[model samples]
Target: MLKMLLLFLIGAAVSIDLIAGQACQPRSANPGRACKKACTHDAQCRGRLKTCQCDNVCGMSCFNPNLACNDPGPFPNGQISPERGYGQVIRYTCNVGYNLRFGNNRTCQSNKQWSGVQPRCDREYWHFFIILFYMGEDL
Candidate 1:
C-alpha cells in the first residue's frame, strides 16, 4: 500500500506542468489566478510561456509575452489590436485605388508569434473597362 501510494504521488506531480498542482491556462481564459506557473528557466515552460523565468526563481516569470511584426507598407493601412501583447489580432485595409491581396486578419498565437500571412495592398486592375472601350472603338 505504501509503495503504491508513493508511486501515485510521484506520477501525479510529474504529469502536471504547473507548480503546486494548480491548473495552468491562458491569462485571458483564467482570471485572478495565475493560469501559468512562474518559471526560472525556459525548459520548464512551453508555448507563450516557454521562456518563463522570474529572477531565477524557477517559477515566477512571464516577462516577454508580447509579439511584434513588420509594417505592411504605405498608402494602404492596417492595425493590430492590443499590438504589444500576446494573442493580438491584426486587421488590414486599402485606399480607393488598392485591393487587399492577402488575408485581412491575423492572430498572435500562444507561441508568442503571429499566425497568418501579412496583408499587402495590391493595385486594382481595370481590365474590364479597357476591354469595353476597345470593343466600342472597333464597333
Candidate 2:
C-alpha cells in the first residue's frame, strides 16, 4: 500500500510539470520569444515584439491601437516618405528658425523598423534673422 501511494504521487507531479512546460513554450508559428499569452486578433499582436495573448492558446499577437499606441504611419519630410517598411526612410527638417538636433534622415532596417526615438527639431536663433527679413519686421 505504501509503494502504491508513492507511485501515484510521483505520477501526479510529473503530469503537472508537463502541463506547465507546455504553457511556457512558444508556438511553432511564432519562432520568437514567447508572448505574454495567446492572442485571438491582429490587434492583440502588433509592434516589434509581434505577440499577444487573447484566447489562452499560444498564438500570434495583433496590433492593438488601444494597448500599444503609436504615431499615425509616417509623414513626408521634404520629398521622402515616412512610411514604415523595407527600403523606406524618413527625413526631417526644422522650420526656418529651427534646426535638426539629430540626423536629418533615418532608414528602415532589414527588419520592419521605425524610429527608435523621435528626433527633435531645434530652434535656430541665427535663422531668426531670415524669418524676420521675410516677414519685413525689425527687432
Candidate 3:
C-alpha cells in the first residue's frame, strides 16, 4: 500500500509538471508574470512582444454586472451562459415573483466593460411598495 501511494504521488506530480509545461511553453512563469525574470539569461526571454507578459492572457474578460437577485439570462426566460468574455452579449431577466427594473441586453465591449446601464431585478412585492411610497409622498 505504501509503495502504491508513493507511486501515485510521483505520477501526479509528473503529470502536473507536464501539463504546466505545455500550458506555459513560452516560459515557466505564468502569463501574469509579465516583465518578471523569466530566465537566468535575459536573451532567453527577449524579442517576444513589447512588454512580453503584459497580462495578455488567452481570453478577454468582462466585468459581469450585478444581477440584483435576478437570474441572468439571454432572454426573458432563457438561461444565462456560464462563459463571458469580450464581445459576448448578456441579457438578464428577473426570476419568478420579480420584475426587471431596468436595463437591456448588453455587450461586453472591447474595453472589457459591459455596455448599457446595469440591470436590476426587483421583487414584485418590493416594487409595489416602492411605487406606493412614492405616490403617497406626492399626494
**Residue-wise C-alpha lDDT for candidate 3, range 1-139, written one tens digit per residue:** 9999999877544322231232222332343322333332223444443122211231211222221222233344333444355445776756787667566466654335455666766556877798889988955
Summarize candidate 1's per-residue lDDT along 82-113 as a digit string, tens digits: 45345456676776667787677765543344
Candidate 1 all-Cα RMSD: 10.6
Q: lDDT tens string, model 2, 1-139?
A: 9999998877543322131243223334653334343444345544764533221222333333234223324332323334555324576666555556656666543223343455666655777687778799654
Q: Give residue 139's lDDT in candidate 3 (0 to 100).
A: 53
Per-residue lDDT, model 1, residue 1, is 100
The residue ranges of model 3 lying beyond 4 angstroms of the native Cα positions read 1-80, 126-139
User: Number of the top candidate by TM-score?
Assistant: 1
Best-fitting candidate, scored by lDDT: 1
TM-score of 1: 0.41
Whole-structure CA lDDT of model 1: 0.51
TM values, all candidates: 0.41, 0.32, 0.33
Model 2: how far is 83 from its true place, Å? 2.8
Considering summed lDDT, which 10 consecutive residues are worst modelled in model 3? Answer: 52-61
Worst 10 residues of 1 by lDDT: 53-62
| Pairs with backbone N, CA or C atoms under 3 Å apart (clashes), candidate 1 | 25-35, 38-59, 38-60, 39-59, 39-60, 40-58
